[model samples]
Target: MDNENNVNKYSKEEQLNESRVNHDDQKLTTNQGVGVSHTDDSLKAGNRGPTLMEDFHFREKMTHFDHERIPERVVHARGFGAHGHFQPYESMAELTKAKFLQDPSIKTPVFVRFSTVVGSKGSADTVRDVRGFATKFYTEDGNYDLVANNIPVFFIQDAIKFPDIVHSIKPEPHNDMPQASAAHDTFWDFVVNTPEITHMIMWLLSDRAIPRSYRMMEGFGVNTFRFVNGEGKGRFVKFHWKPLLGVHSLVWDEAQKLAGKDPDYHRRDLWDAISKGDYPEYELGIQIIEEEDEFNFDFDVLDPTKIWPEEIVPVKPIGKMTLDRNVDNFFAETEQVAFHPANVVPGIDFTNDPLLQGRLFSYLDTQLIRLGGPNFHEIPINRPLAPIHNNQREGYHRMTIDQGVTSYSPNSLRGNAPHPTPDTEHGYAHYTEKVDGKKVRERSESFNDHYSQASLFWNSMSNAEKEHIIEAFHFEVGAVMDKQIKERVVEMFNHVDGELATEIAKGIGVAPPQNPGGTGVTASSPAVSQENTNQVAATRKVAILLEDGFNHHQVTQVMEALKSAGVHSEIISKNLGMLTGVDGQQLEVNKNYVNTGSIMYDAVYIPGGRQSVDNLLQQGDALHFVNEAFKHGKTIGATNEGVDLLVISQVEGIELAALDSQAELVSKMGIVTIRNAGDMGTIEQEGYFSQQFVSAIAQHRHWKRKNKKEMVPA
Candidate 1:
């Protein structure tokens, strides 16, 4: 069933819409709604004289403007949010009594914020860093928050070490030189000292750190929580959000170039997608372990730096969320929204996960300062649809005006108003988890094995992913000025995998470990590899290159096929305007070479035309576009005379149909070429070619071409 049909059923979106104000045809007014006759000059004693303090309007306006800015979040500062609704595919009543999960007919209104953990408010979005994937579900019971991250693991196992890791990964305080990067001496030094972080470091260096788009990445709750049923039976659970588009990532080169070319690349992609009705969708999956089976695993269930292999405990998808609406005002909604991990409704409870226990307090504490007050929840985006009634009174920016003769409970004056709720009435009840432990600052013994999973992660990687991880280590560790720290990093990783450490040492100028021994964990989890992710051409963007005298029939035929396959195409040429084909067919260009580049698209296509090919061959920009795209392993398509341009572009190591061939279609190394395409008389024949092109794009990247990519000049 289509999720788009349920967009208007969300009460949260309708509530937010009520707060939206239009400035068109409205008179200027002050905070107290006093209509002002003048506001520009402020009430002055004379035209050039000193202004008087008696001008109340001037004082109020200036005061509001001066205090308009609030403190930005310390981490996850760069965030983008969208509104959506979630619906369960089937009732999960057997697992949890959470009202939102128990009902299949109810659509829970949700607001999701995607962010980068280490970046400042103004930092670029494409930085290689952990991304925050926090979601707030406004249910009938209350607001249930699922605060998560793009990576399933974290750097430190305990939350108390959060500040230290943040300090080391952030720009060095002395110079603050490397903005939004972990490539420095401090981070490597921390890595060498903190052995438990080895598993997370492996993930950080992988392609998952740099997602192709926010819509394509995965989300994990990171810490374990509890799912309590109506019978009070509890199970350990971990949350996951799997994007329907599949997991994809950008190459290091593309990410670096796009950071400078467009700092807001991720947010722009999300905004544009929703505006065009190409809403992002994710299925909510849970990995659950019965209370009795918790100790059956070798690793501690409470450790935050570990993942339960999907093969062992498969992910059961419970519901789906569709982000069908964009925020009307970024500041009022995306900026002001608050999320706390402790925001649980009935049937959801916490575990003894130390990292999660620490976050329970930290998230709320940070929001108090960042959002200016505890009353931040009163903000339209954060306010829940459930009725809120309590004895608690006013604070800074409190929107509610409580009325009663008595504000305290247990008084005859008001007959005990705002009484507590029982379990039968859906009141939140903490699971009765037996606890018998001493209060001490010590970690459990079960949390000590850090290298086993790290080795498993290394073993699970496909050859292409392994190569990317090694190159990532080269860039990150190679930036460390301290040679001792670099050598120590190599040694620390030796425990995870001998070959991985040796390869890391090769790039960072460190000697290979003297005793390069792995954890001897040979088992691999195929689910962790991006090579096994879903592949589809839907929502993929393709850039169509054309100039005057392009083949209109070929362009029209291929574009129709792409559209039918749910692909978006844009005409990119030397200049913006109408281009006349050889057959006198005109088409408008969406972007010009000066304003856009090859990095902005997923793939490239060139339609055949004698004049267009001749003109493109002369322009260095056009050849560079083709070469650069090929270097990045993106799909490239050429039809008829378009094949001549690819040949001149010097994308070698692949066989292409010769210019004289008879309707030959040569598909090799993710490059599709057709010779004598004008000879095709039917759309069916053209569709076969288009189908091959789209299928190539679906593979995301042709890693087999990486070995030959270095030969390209661009």
Candidate 2:
């Protein structure tokens, strides 16, 4: 199914396609719709002479081309987006009157953009950095934008520090040496000085930073919001988007290699998935607490740097979003679509979180400049489904021409048109949360306990996860030229965990801390760990290694099982073309050893054939591919003479099935091997060896296996 679009009668698609222009079979024309001929050459005095000044066509064409580009976002410049619809599981009329949440039957059209925070428009997609997961919903009330990030918490508690943090993480401005990276002196210096960044830095260093794909990571609002009921009551709420596919990440080694192998890796993954009808799905969840219980938590709910742990305020699944369509044009829809946190509908209001409050002003101001004035909301991608009113007039790029004689309120000529709807009606009414605080440049004392939550995050990680965090710290902090900054960072993180700091210090050649203490908050928030998320093999990509003269029946049997198990498999060989097996079965090779690497797949399989196995053993490219997959802790499987290739590959101390008489199938660790199997099961139900391989892949990665002794060059 190329598109499952027929399953949904989505209104958003109707609106978007209304403006779509297909130039097929159409005559070329100028901007004024005047037909043109001979556009190949400019209107010139002669064949090789200067252009004529009276040629209006050339002037119009060149002028438009000159102004084609717009300013990319200062942050989140490189982005990929998709069209989707959101529908709630059930109505939440009691808690909030937001129409989108009040009906399970309605599908609200949405545009979601996934991006990297620090990189420029041309940066690699797989860089180790924070990802932005902002969604714009064309709801009936208005376009509500949920500007979010992959990390649940943020680097700073207040919005004033956003500039400082972004400036620090970006490459040192003087030299601009390291592009799309935070491995520099400025970032480390910022971290050591701002203790409020403690918790978020831990998250930044975790595997979460290097998501396997946009379809496989979690997103958070990173701010406290309000859910106002129709009865004029409110509750504190935090938003979350949990991917249906389990949270997964590429190892640092794979991520670094992928940057060179494919800078558009994540973007291509999303586009391909949707194009193939394997639409990415995410469930919208909300963590709500009563307005009266705001003071019940140890940390301030308004602090952007603190997370309301799921165990404490459980995430109630409210709705699901599915991205079923790719954009027709990237620049028109994805790039120009403006998103602002303040673009909320009725029954939804903002909290007093300093970050949220400042963003309300900053996001609008940014669009004014980037999209060229206040008319950005008039853009097709940013327009709302709801009707537009008010006396506001447009400025630059204004498309609307007012048809009214009187544009001001209380004008007799226009009969006082577009009268304001009151709270009794459907008009938006801001929540009446009383506020009285002294004007001072200070953070609340409640936001002071940053180390506690940072400690909570460290303790919650699995051993392998913790090791990755330590390694990330070593890589990031060690790159700092100033030894003093590196040492200060280690000492600062000593507050999160002494062992974590010690391990990082050892790797970076920094001095061990004189005193280290695990922040007194030792309680682990298990829900924060990726190890605790869902696990499945659905939609996983597997590379099937094959060559001419391979066992056709065995290959068919294994592939059928993988297909039935919802795994995507591709045939790879030394060259791209057709490969014929001994039994005359032919397979088309889509990718070759030189083009595709082991880092691109979730698992690998090899079917036995004397000619194929013999040829593969002699090729360094083929051998390195298998060894790299094993070193990355991915599942490996082979059958009959294929087992000989694994043995010959000689991946150091790693174990493989022997050739001697034994059971037909042998499962050693994550590697499944079979030999001398006379009776093969039906394709529907594969043999034990194939089943074992599939099961191993379901576990994502074999983290427990120690590959230090069996390391292979990747």
Candidate 3:
């Protein structure tokens, strides 16, 4: 019943360990051929003496260890990847001639890398930044890379400003004060100067940036691209990946705490979910706009800082992808796998989006230095399932040997082999869109309207979401030592919304900007709000606290009911092992007070028993467990003596319905307590209690409930 035992039941860790095949597995001996004993340890002179120069073992280990680390990505250095397959829901022959899209039965192998854009490899995962959700699909024709992010918008419109934005967000050169954080003077100054980043800044400050789990958030190809059909017809398209579990996020405080509690929070969530058969699923959705109707929308399609609102051009769910396997080796598979937007099939093509254009160069350029050569594609994880044939050869780390002396085209000796195939043969043909412009460093006038979409995002958020955004802005801006930078940020964001600027100003102790500007755009997209997302209790963790002499039968029944609804329940007691029930039943303990905290789980449950209640009351930490759960707006259920803890804790206006009294205690309120067994039975049987609990959990916190007691309970 311990975490180790529960983890062993899944065997995911064992499978991961087995997947990592060391060089010793091939039975290859050392150059000396004197069968080696200790591969993990280097040979020492004598009892941890200076490493001997003649020690081949020590030399080999040090040589390999020295080269263990590859160059971290210039951007998105911290990343985690998984293996999956994509299956189209139906054929889309009319839209595109791509074989992968044309065949509904074909399952395309995919490797997806979820990354933090600004952090280094060793940085924390729960930072306020955009998450890179890049997917590489190995189709029959070639690999199609859908390089994307959790946010639909980018920080800038043109690729030229990419380096500038990146430099601003990165740690300052003078002292490198902040690591993996944008809440600094440089970042604010850049934002205030470049208003185009307003929309993405709004998203970065929202809870969406700090996702509860990578499996539960949405991904978007931030730039527009074109889809070419067999007939040469083209349509501008934007890709989206909608998670099956819907979008969920952690409270800012919780996210920060989790960074310390578990730096691998997102990675562990993904591995654990897949290992337990809860495969992460995402549906491939596309927003298609006809070539002729491209100019029909009010916003510019090529602007990377804007979104084609789903309300205007609805996303057509085309395919589904499920990540069923974890990586074999972090360095060989996850780290070596290269993704570039330039990797496209016959049907897929790029647009004139400048940011996308720059990424096309950046991805390939970074791989050459990071992976040590142009032959990175030969890496097992990056290899295309389809056959490869070409005259190009002889790069660093070349693993393949060309048979003949014909490494170039136009050679009769090679029978003109590997010749270029026509477009009809499913060859990659670029879209033939006419373009005529003088070479100049300038932005399109159409891309000038930056504040419109930013305002639209502000208008779309729910009240609770707005509050969180304001708090986020306050926390970030308040961290800046420069007061002028904070004032400038408030003034600049005033264009997005007056209320937003005012709220942020109030929290940061700055004067609200007078007469905040507006873009006169009244558009709003409801899909941007998390409150409208699908809510479920499936896979949500609920902690059940119990002690000796507890009402085991009632607790067991409640736990079973939760499990039947797909809720994960963990029993936590003061000690590990087993606790005896009132009826002499032994209940397994999943966690002890010393090992777990209230922040680890989604909700808390307490069972009614005289001895258990008395024991819990005596333990100060146990009382804190209830208070913290309540502070988080999690549901609390108690029948008999369990209710006593709530009373002793002095919860304000604590109301309990008398057994069989038939009286309601403030309908649809923050807290609920049932006295009668029959009422509890009705609540459980009808699933009303479960629904209420799930709703409370989704709300995340009840800001309405104010704690009145002055004395701090210790």
lDDT of each candidate versus the true structure: 0.87, 0.83, 0.77
lDDT tens per residue, model 3, 329-355: 999988888998999999988877766
Q: What is the lDDT for 57 in model 3?
A: 51
Enumerate clash totals for all models, in the order shown.
Answer: 0, 0, 0
Query: How close is every model to the real structure, measured as TM-score?
Result: 0.89, 0.89, 0.86
Q: What is the C-alpha RMSD of each candidate to the true structure, in Å?
A: 16.1, 16.2, 15.1
Clashes of 1: 0
Per-residue lDDT over 475-502 for candidate 1, one digit per residue giving the tens place of the 0 to 100 score: 9999987787898898888998899999
lDDT computed for candidate 1: 0.87
TM-score of 3: 0.86
For model 1, what is the alpha-carbon lDDT of residue 54? 67
lDDT tens digits by residue: candidate 2, 1-714: 435664343333453344245757689788999987645334433322223446666556544432333588878889999999999999998889898998899999999999999888899999999999999999988889999999999988655456668778887765675888989877888889889989999999899999999999999999889998888889999999999988999989889999999899999999989998889999999999997898899888888899999899999999999999999999999899888999998988988786676576567767777888889888999888888988888689888888877778888787788788887767888878555543334556677787999989988999989988988988998887777788888889888888888888998888878887677777989889999888888788888888899988888877888887878899999999999999998989989978889999998888889999988888888888888888887888888888887887745565567687665676666788878664334324455766777777878887766554245666
Better of 2 and 3 by lDDT: 2
Candidate 2 deviant stretches above 4 angstroms: 1-70, 650-654, 661-663, 678-687, 707-710
